[model samples]
Target chain A: MSNKSLIVTLLATTLLSGPAFAEDVTLTIESWRNDDLTLWQDKIIPAFEASHPGIKVKFTPSAPAEYNAVLNSKLDAGSAGDLITCRPFDASLALYDAGHLADVSGLENMSNFSDVAKSAWQTDDGSATFCVPMASVIHGFIYNKEAFEEVGVEVPQTETEFFAALDKFKEDGSYIPLAMGTNDQWEAATMGYNNIGPNYWKGEEGRLALIKGEQKLTDDQWVAPYRTLAKWSDYLGDGYEAQTYPDSQNLFTLGRAAIYPAGSWEITGFNAQADFEMGAFKPPVQNEGDTCYISDHTDIAIGLNAKSENADAAKTFLNWVGSEEFATIYANALPGFFSLSSFDVAMEDPLAQEFVSWRGECESTIRSTYQILSRGTPNLENETWGASVAAIKGTKSAEDLGKELQDGLASWYEPQQ
Target chain B: MKSPRIKSHVIVFLAPAVLVYTAIMIFPLFNTLRLALYTEADQVRMFVGLENFRTLFGDPRWSESFWNALANNFWFFVIHMLVQNPIGIALAAILSHPRLRFAAFYRSAIFVPTILSFVIVGFAWKLILSPIWGIAPDLLSAVGLKSLFAPWLGKEEYALTTLALISVWQFVGIPMMLIYAALLSIPEEVLEAGEVDGITGMAAFWKIKLPLILPSIGIISILTFVGNFNAFDLIYTAQGALAGPDFSTDILGTFMYRTFFGFQLQLGDPHMGSAIATAMFGIILVGVCIYLFGIQTRLKRYQF
Candidate 1:
């Protein structure tokens, strides 16, 4: 062939061959896990990429505080990533209602999730699955074991013993009984209200009843918990209101406080910096020998964007997320959080094993205030936090908080019957 | 004869500005006003007229927070007027003195905080004033004023005032620069004439310099009023959307944000958020109108 003809033939051949070569598909996954970027980059993405050739995963991480706003804006612009982080209840519901989340009901791994895990990421009608449940977080008190031993106080199992333990720490005068950071407001609710609120509400049934208007927040059952929170506030030490969430965590890690109530998500962080041995316990029950309810709610779940051009590839990524391999990687990367799947994954961290031990021993697992509050009105979460602060400061009585809660609920809650 | 035609250049120059302004500012303002008259229920939006306003002002749950925020907003503006403006004027007067050393350096140093983002300022102040951290307390103790130190940002009684002070500290440079420029524009001959008439230093500033800068002061006052009323970022960064310690630091901006966007457990109500915005707009409009008609007319501008 002539030189010109050969060059042209090579160009045409290459051009024609391009159609036969499979293009690499990039699935964008957005999460508000800026702190754990290394985990996703080094472990999760690499594992997924290795198993599935010709498919590349791009992870976009945002700060936790601004994640929801950023995600909403992306969804509104119809440019959200293929796989998105899904917050449980109202946040997930809103996206599902807007048809932004793909229905992955028929995925084979969907059957692996427990009913509780499935329900958390399910639509209101329970007819379709919108996300693959990833992990569940437990909330309770993380105590400084050395501080407890120094004060000669053992972990309490009931309300009376808990108070006695606080008194002992108070008498010691060196350590704060409860390292509460009320300045952030939500920390108080996350550490105290969610951990202890279920005791008075009587777990899931009572919360559901409250939602249905069968029970009022002002009812006698709630007064005890409110009063208990108020009493617990006294043990938080001086200038507790000025302490921030990170401040409280620091206090606990430094052994300045005996106990710090927080979620399982904090375990990985605490383990890295804590000088003292750390231990966690379920909040004590009100009545002696009564079973305690632990705050075990879905923490993070991955949803496929319904409008994504690469839905099939996204589904494949999500299916692998539900597999045993992904669960092992995820659970190990963040040690304390338990995987929602029924796969036999061994938890390596002793602290994580301590928390996981409660799963079988506790009377029941309950949702936090984030999940139980009515979705129709302005968020009751803030109101509850405000009430807790007010109760702590003696600005509002328990009865006053109860009435405030009822008024807040009355804004959007209607009687079901 | 044909009617006079406007020139193409006029249309071309005006079109871009007008189009940009309408798209960004005017359109959104009207749309928010329209949204205020509607309500959403179970995914359906319906016209509810002034019912949202009634709910905002009448329902005890909503009204309490609304009134609290409005009152707090007013106090925030008052603090800036009473504290920031006076300090700014004083600083400007001192810096305007002809023989003052390093005047440019001082001016730039004072203006530094104004350029910092609200998030940075909020968190920085939060850390500095934190009782647990002891930065402020330690400083006070070093000066033998430990007894005077308090958790100013955490207390309900002091949180709003502390935040207002922080904002004032950041923004006082704006008024200082404007007043300084006004002071600089005053004729040296006029001041020399004043000295011939036995006026000098403090007396000269009070009689001549202050009067000449009255127009600038008036402008600064209106700007501070508008800025304070619309303040949200600092409070949100420092206290969160709840604006807590019992919502003592809550203001119209935070209230509107929480209502419009919703927080944990609460679904957003755009209509109610719009109503709050409309309320804020009305307040700002009234303040601006009062300044334009009542205050500005009385403050005579002296063309030096």
Candidate 2:
């Protein structure tokens, strides 16, 4: 046989063998959704894998409390999964800044996200998108509808009315006016200060001004919110300091408290455990007729590891996550969290619906304390939270709390300058 | 050495353990110290000699939390020393008595909590002390001391002390067991000699037994010092990363963790975290040194 003819025969043989040689790519997705493992195992993964042939997704779950640290170690070791779930702001930004996150900006479904959601996963310069926005959580007071009706109190729209409602509950003396669990210091900041502080700060502009050093936390506007928080502390009832996050949730669910301020994440737990009818309301504004602000923050977003060997497969999965199809699946599976995508899903839960209704109705949605304080500033939340605890305990005045916040902010802001 | 050289098998047998120890313990220890000298800014890590340490000590924001945690840690140690050691010593004394009944059962029961996970112990105590649950309150009320139940774990003034006590309750068995073993090794002849010399019971223990067990007690004290200073899991499990009720229960371990990992709103600064860790290492080193030189040297171990 001629050499050319022999070579042609070998080439033809290799080409024919290619179909059998193709390997299924396995993409590992790391997440802190241990509680919702069933959702991923039963629904999300199967749906993704079904559509994308020759690709298998391996879900790696860790406890939420240890997820970031675990992810950090993995990333440092250059052994992180192909896909990673990151907390929005500092957590995602840190990875993005370190060039550990793959810039999936060219993903076709990026346009499906709103500007707010898009900005969350993007760099400060808006030059790179590190992750696909999955869900944004709403923070508000989860109240007992039965207790409100029994006391003939309308859902408060204003701070004055809110205080009056608390008085009504206090007068009834059968239930706690507000369930506050400051024992876990973050809870006070999360449920109390952050939920209420934004109403006084106006919105994103006010928060940005503070972040940019254009406004001091000790300013009258900022101080007013803390004062309001201090006043609200009065309605927490005796032994409120001793109350834990779970205890507060238990109190609200058991009809011991009229109102429980928390994030929408607790909806599923509340619904399953609560014996009485539960309703949610946006925290009241300073004035009777003023527009109230809702505390909205990104819950979880999917980021691709830049160092992943299966980058193409990871991007494919992330692009799918940004699609309307994935949004539907996500929304159906975790109905409590509001999807950040333009894709609309009907929320059947009344409490969740109430929060969704506030998306357009409320004056504005602002970042939660965790997001605001976590950016570039170290221990600001703890310091501010400590001050808030002191204010609630009547050990420190609201003015002192404001000053302390100002001092803490200056410590962070001055060093940067 | 010239007469007989070490065998190849000795080196072969020793290499695995030495390699394992160096990889797990010594390498990481030195690496953590090395990380302390570098600071990351805008995702770029730069070598900044002593800058992180200076910031930790001089910066009000870092220093304040550092000092508060340090102070609280000291108090935590003091509580264990004052309440835990004494109680453990007394329990060991009682249990080690020749005439004691159900000694085995009591020893096992007392040591049970020590074997349990810190997470379980912390959460268990948290629930037991919860005011809303009425477990602690009802118990207090039963004794007509309900007013005295002031939510000790929730109060800034009391949170650290309450947690310290809880830690003590869980770990008292450790010192008890160690001291008990030491007491059991007391030869009986020496104790009999004490009895004959008019040193009976309390006199025998205080004059004869305790002095002989001083070396063991010293070792236990140093162990307690190290354990208490390095405590994190209990506080983190119970009060959370914030170590809250306004960080009153914040200890060095929790502080280092929060600084290292960055909790809530704070970005994790590895350099700063490492500096804090290095500081902790120094503190531990100093403590170990003091025990070895200042305390351990004076504690004469008997030949018994």
Candidate 3:
């Protein structure tokens, strides 16, 4: 008799809650940018909600390094959020091919992004666009202004000058010359190799050529960067082999390190932690007259979950994500992340301004291994990470590392073969 | 009719436990083993039948990483066997002394790390050992031994060993406690007998206490083997998924995790992951079986 009453009570409660829940559509976003949680909740989501009263949005994020694993598991279990944050290149491309992410070509203001901006999320044949281009991070060095004065060095423009300044810092005895570590291996590659690489590769020309199999990694353009990276360890203070990403950041921000090999993404973070004034400089050119090329890598984008129940509301949210207003908000909220859109944003932060200003001064290219080249076994990105660390540590010669990368690529990547 | 009546009670009582076990343990174990035998081919899940194992063992890329992980895993285990166990046994011996004062304080202090989360232990040690801002350099410098310090966690040469020691520091308490309890449970009359025979202190421990606690020590050894093989969190927290300083610390668990779950830009292949898991299972099974069928039978278990 009590069982029947319990069943009736459950039915009644379900009926009551169902209608109330339906009154407002809540869309959850999966992202790896945990640092931007408060910014999203306070500004981005509230702004979106204010425009669309019936739709509510929640921004959920996991650790940056664990994001790929977390998102894949969640998607496999059918518990993914309505909106999915997208990594650049083959990683997100896999999700799109798997039908986990929906096409967003029909999204409002989709045309606002350039061909280059949408290049990361588009199908190989350039038929379908799956994610809205959000932001790109430029690679450079973030230096302490005070440290520069103490070391008696001006901002370096040439590779020779860069090394000279590093030598000066070393002689000064108070500061670490270059602040970067191989502990978290990606920082060693992302901030070290990829940052300085384009200066040798000639940016998009070499990257595109490498993709087409016209330029091998063994070529002078590619191997030259590794040769340069081998010298980086000497300036990286003693015991840098064990120093982590956070340690490097702390070293620079605490005014103990003169220059930090950086992605523009570090601006917001460095700004928060640092007390001393900071400045930004692009990767120093090998020659005085050489055209500088920056790694203006498209970092993150957002796409719709194909299996979302609130597809319409999610589409509405995605359309907003493509807009200039969203671009401005996101780019400014995270100063280091410049908008991928053609919309020229006036960044309030000076360090960010310095990074973005390079777009006009230099040719820009994404990381060489990020695109289709990394699709196979012995992933090129992973290979580059180890290779970079080895280069810095001088455990492997540049020639050997180049051959290893090529060999690994040839083992799987057909174009390289 | 009476037999049927008796069987019904057994079936009813056994049903819940049997069902739960099958769902959680038995099913997953079989499924993982089954998955090791299959793989995705042309977007279709098909029976590859030893293909994954062939690739794992024969292919240079797969085999190199596999062998490396296996070797590192052995080293990780050897460190525990050589260092952690001996330290634990020594601590247990010292603490078991009847004349020892503040034994409770020492026991609690030593055992505290064992109860702490792997994440806390990993990060805490990482911080303590950090060269940039860590206290380790400061502490060493204070003693004029600053030159003796190197970035232990960052160097490829020392990363695995340093991590092993940190792990030993965290988990030494487990074996210590087990051996302590085993030592305490030995009848006081036995010690009294040893006292009358000139077997006191070290001699008494070697002759009386050590032999009786051999079973417990055996159990602790097996437990350490299993725990070390299964370790992922501490390494993941301290080093990261790639187990860096150039994958120097990659063990079976991390390798399996990286293969199965993927990390960074590398895509996960569950079939390959399952194959690695199966390999790990085989290794562990061999260890456990040796302990159970060979070692355990030789060790004498005593009763009061």
Q: Which candidate is the best by lDDT?
A: 3
Worst 10-residue stretch by lDDT in candidate 1 chain A?
A363-372
What lDDT score is found at residue A311 in candidate 3?
A: 97
Off by over 4 Å in 1: A1-22, B1-5
Model 2 lDDT per residue over A1-417, tens place: 699999999999899878755667899988988878888889999999899988899888998878888888999999899999978776788888788898888999998987778777787778888899999888888899999999899998887788899999999999999898678766767677777877888877677777666777778877776677777677885677888878888888888899988888888889889999988888888776677677787778999999999888888899999988888888767767888998787767787888878888775555634444545555566677777677677788888888877776665565323
Residue range B69-142, candidate 1, lDDT tens digits: 99999899999999999999999999998899999999999999999999999999999998887689899999
Model 1 interface CAPRI class: medium
Which residue pairs of candidate 1 clash? A379-B266
TM-score of 3: 0.95
Per-residue C-alpha lDDT of model 3 across residues A160-189, encoded as one tens digit per residue: 999999889888889989989889999878
lDDT of each: 0.85, 0.84, 0.91
Q: Ten consecutive residues with minimal summed lDDT in candidate 3 chain A?
A: A408-417
Best by TM-score: 3
A best-first ranking of the candidates according to their TM-score comes to: 3, 1, 2
Better-scoring candidate (lDDT), 1 or 3:
3
